[model samples]
Target: MNQPLHLMTPEVRANPYPLYAELRRRPVCQVEPGGMWAVSRYDDVVTVLKDARRFSSAGLGQSFRPPWLEHNPTADSLVMKDPPDHTRLRTMLSRAFSGSALSRWESSIRAIAEELAEATVRRQEVDFVAEFAMPLPARVLNLFYGLEPSMALRLKRWADDLVSIPASQPSPQRMEEIRHSLAEMERCFNALIEARRASPGEDLVSELIRTEALTHEELLGFLFGLVPAGVETTVYLLANTMYVLSEHPREMERVRDNPALIPRLVEEVLRYEPPGQSSLRLTTEDVELSGVTIPRGAIVIALMGAAMRDESRFPQADRFIIDREAQSNLAFGHGPHFCLGAMLARMEARLGLEALFSRIRGFSLQRRDFAWSQSIIARGPLTLPLHLEPSRR
Candidate 1:
């Protein structure tokens, strides 16, 4: 009887929790915003992620089109694939970047975060997104893989354009930009693969080069996946965490005093401000979900941003509280396609957050210039230009 508030405008993308609060009044329904359906309730969204048999992610690619969306190809991207294909591809890629094998990275990650923090502590001001957030993980990932610094920066820019939510359906111009970026990325990967073939290092690229299951092309795709996933996801996570810290000076100071809290704080940050959001699925056959009939081949998109804030699951879901035992948020994802770099992302956040608070005597948002990145899928700051009171000690 009512149109979901999120469909009204971009408010859901801007501040989804408020909309989630309203939707909780009547959580599950087939929201008809120009024929495409959205399942808002927490249980409903969770089922979509969990039940691979009834609902298929492969069919979801371009399965539903809202009236507002333009000619964006909804083809099955990496997250949309299924079964042996999904498992195989994921394993090949995971072998290279899976965080468990790389626990040793923490020391290096901590060192890098410390260096960035020390650099900023002396100067007393920094744009956390560009100066700190974007570069920290991007450079670290590339360096770990033995990639050149310059190429890493280039790939990061290309990733921003590719993953950036367009104002409307992407223009032909934007598509061209994406194509060129992809080409350049592939070219760089090609060169790297060639080098790895000659004299392999103990890097992800080298490991992938040696993997029997992965072909050269798949290897490229696997590495290319990291191009956006590594840089963009961490960028959002770090920005959100910093914004959280800046707002909650007490919480910020707690972790500052004890660096050991970094891991706990990082988990809470993931629950509070997950970097990755929204996974899509398609109802393979006519099925019932939360009292709503999802027709055959209907597209379903779970807004993790919305699901994480479901009050039924998370009381006072809107509040950003750290050091609590909140369940793992869908930020990295669920089911078969959960983030391969989950561990690394967590370590980076913890180390970076620790280094930041430890070095800066006082850090708070420079609200006058504070701005948010307006993308369809992510909510993070474009520039967290924090003002420092300067480290007295």
Candidate 2:
């Protein structure tokens, strides 16, 4: 297993489990060419994610943030903060993103899912990524932030760029594109915030506007984090769930028959094939793990996808089984920085799957050949082409 498992490799991108299984033999393997440590096993990944004091999330790409974003209040979001600061930011922002708030949107989310499913079925042959998976989260977020549906497309573009930039070392041209996207996002959010201030709406943005805990600058920066948080990963989650279910006919049939199990199916997909493969963290101080020493200021990557498949934590971890007992999966992350939108992501996915199966019968992949996104940070089919059959009423 001497072959490189660098972030951008095709082998790791296409299917990374075998590589992960090999790397887990050594809980922490130093990835050469870049000198970063890869923590693969479940325990180590948890240790890195949970012990924020030892491993900081702030310095993932020290050179990446452009001046505009560098000064934004959200620049120090929950994702990039450690302990006290992270705790405080999460608490203030959690008010509008609380469980009750998320539950209130369930009916509307289901309706959106139903409408998307109907449209997808009418298309007969469609790319699930573009048609259902992508827009589903965007539209739901639109409703959440009180933005018009027209903003979904531009927001999706901004979010896709935002999520991808930090993970890879982009060329100068790509960096400019990312900066431009960030500027556009900042401008768009600022306008929305001002509108919410003028005439408060029954939405998350308006609610946050009313809060005194976060200043306008901080609120704007947090919104930058929120767009991608609410959109990108969930988009991949929905896409991956559909691909897995369609591949596993028995499981698909079971969920289609018993719609209640749709949530369980979503969980299994998160474990079996997480949307986010890894997250970057910086070592705050020297630390030793599983006999390997990580020097101070070293880059540490927690392989969430690999950890979810750790045999010690998960029985038959490689397989996707919906009925498995409840176990913590790292897909939505762990520790204090656990995803704020996890509840919303789950609702959209569960509802989206239910709507698809209920309205469209004989739904199947149009082709077996598919290309996975070449991003080590996330994993899913880039284009999920499928044929949707009419309902068998």
Candidate 3:
């Protein structure tokens, strides 16, 4: 029997389409070392995500499982559990993320997008991640907590430290720094929690505190979550989305022509290059598919990007088809724990892309181009350099 693909290898990380194609050859597969099973074909990937029972999110660590802290009560947090725990947390958090929160922030988010776009245009050659991707969601969500501009930027950094821990064989000092940064986030968020108690604002944080259902720890967990989950995932999505669009200018041209197509085009980009390339879900019980028996507690890194490109589901999967119907991809995940911030993330990508293209005109990669931050769990560009259309001299 042939060995399973080593997903974290440099070559695969650079471009895993070929590896994914191989997985499609064997519909059900398992990787050694971590004993992580991967379902790469579109149907299998979707089924694993859809059925929370047999396949489990608990196999994945807690959403609020602090890297530093030992305990995690909020394993009940939406990203980390199954059935009753996952459902309850998702329900409560969904209420916070609903129309009420996003509706109130529409004007502010629009203004933030406009400002960021304006700044990007001023500098024709820009790095989309820092200039546009990171800031759009960072600043808008910062507004939610009534954070000071400087503190907001620091909070953004803290979130980065938590999510963007590099995979280099670095020193122990570096690891300490990461844990310290997470501690700082806790201190800062606790202060904000106190502020909300004093005088609540019309923001998600304040709204969350008002819920009265969550304890102080739960409230703090949500705040930390809003930092990384809110900022990192959306930022990664924007950067990756921009990279995909810039690489396929013809596809982008289509969107520019039909402005309304921007929304659907965003979906296509997400499926094309998801923020999280792959994620883990453990099997709760022995599950059989395609003559492969996946035992209980087996780790499954659902290869979302590959699933997005499955030829069976997507004809001419390799080609950049902007108008492609993005139904089958598990980009936002599936099941009860489907992404809570899907609407907000989609909105940000739409605004970021629309704002950039409307002003910047043509865009192409420049200098070092995009660099993928190597983590088996997440996939995103650390830096994305692009040469933009220069204003008339």
Ranking by lDDT: 2, 3, 1
Ranking by TM-score: 2, 3, 1
Please state the error at residue 312 of candidate 3 in Å: 1.8
Best candidate, TM-score-wise? 2
- lDDT (Cα atoms) of all candidates against the true structure: 0.70, 0.83, 0.74
Kindly indicate the candidate among 1 and 2 with the higher lDDT.
2
Model 3: residue 218 alpha-carbon error in angstroms: 1.6
Counted clashes in each candidate structure: 0, 2, 0
Candidate 3 lDDT by residue in tens digits, 265-311: 77776777777777677788899876788888777777888888898
CA error at residue 176 for candidate 3, angstroms: 1.3
TM-score winner, 2 or 3: 2
> What is candidate 1's lDDT per residue for 91-153, written digit by digit as tens?
667755655667767787788789877787676667778778887888787877787777657
Model 2 residue 282 CA deviation (Å) reads 0.6
**Which residue runs does candidate 1 get wrong by more than 4 Å?**
7-10, 30-35, 59-77, 98-100, 165-168
When 1 and 2 are scored with TM-score, the better candidate is 2
Colliding residue pairs in candidate 3: none
For candidate 2, the 10 contiguous residues with the lowest summed lDDT are: 67-76
Name the candidate that leads on lDDT.
2
Candidate 3 regions exceeding 4 Å error are 62-76, 164-170, 326-328, 390-393
